[model samples]
Target: MPMEIRLVRIDDRLIHGQVATVWAKVTKVNRILVVSDDVAKDILRKTLLKQASPPGVIVNVITIDKMISIFNDPKFNDFKSMLLFTSPRDARRVVEGGVKLDTINIGGMSFSDGKKMITNAVAVNSEDIEDLKYLNEQGIKLEIRKVVADNKVYMMDLLKKEKMI
Candidate 1:
């Protein structure tokens, strides 16, 4: 069962304005699946995320492992969805778990400890660089763009320029 995962994004603020309002309209995916262990366990955060969803679009905040399991569950594969991850490592894990995705959008990763600022609104830690490099080496396309209005900047190309990967 090829899950209709229209887009994969790594946004720390899972279902924020750009995703809730802009990208959702751009991708036209009816469902939003936020796959993150931390968010899935926080009831308050999960509720807030659901509330932010655009009308007519359903949102599900689920654990990373559960998300991987859903691929085999026919009931979960019925709708087209935009997949969200909080980190590049998790995104890599899901693809490794067998979900089909050729391109990933680097939406926004907030600067935190161990993270190096790559581009404005985008940052990468050592693990993030490693995982993203792995995805690129495995033939996945990576783009860092905040919204539809911004130009699509292929992240791997920048990484090469920086000698990070």
Candidate 2:
């Protein structure tokens, strides 16, 4: 069965103003499926995220396993949803677990210790590079674009140029 996953985006701040008002309009996605164990279990964060979504858009906070299950289920085949993951590992899990995607977007990861800052908001570590390499090997197109209007930079090429991997 084919899943109507319009966008597979890795954004730390999920369902915020830009995502709710801009990306949703550009992608035309009605549902936003946030796949993350940490966020799924956080009541306050989850509620805040839910409230951030636009009035007509449905936002679902689920774990990686739950997203895998949902992808396997036939009921969501027709749902036009954006799959949001907090990390590359989380995105890799769903893709490796039988979910299909031709493209993946990296919006933000935030700078942190032991992580190389690739873009203004995207910082990647060794594990993230490995996950990205795996996805590239699987023939998934990867790009770094903060918002819909921004010009997307091919992530793998950027990694090669920066010698991060």
Candidate topping TM-score: 2
TM-score of each prediction:
0.95, 0.96
| Clashing residue pairs for model 1 | none
* Tens-digit per-residue lDDT, 1-165, candidate 2: 765889889989877778888889888988999999999999999998888887678898999888888885788877789989899999998888878888999999978899988888899999999999999999999999888999989999999999876
The TM-score obtained by model 2 is 0.96
- Per residue, candidate 1 scores C-alpha lDDT tens digits across 7-96 of 889889888888988889888999999998889999999999999999889999988788788877789767789999999999888878
Worst 10 residues of 1 by lDDT: 71-80
lDDT per prediction?
A: 0.88, 0.89
TM for candidate 1 is 0.95
Best by lDDT: 2
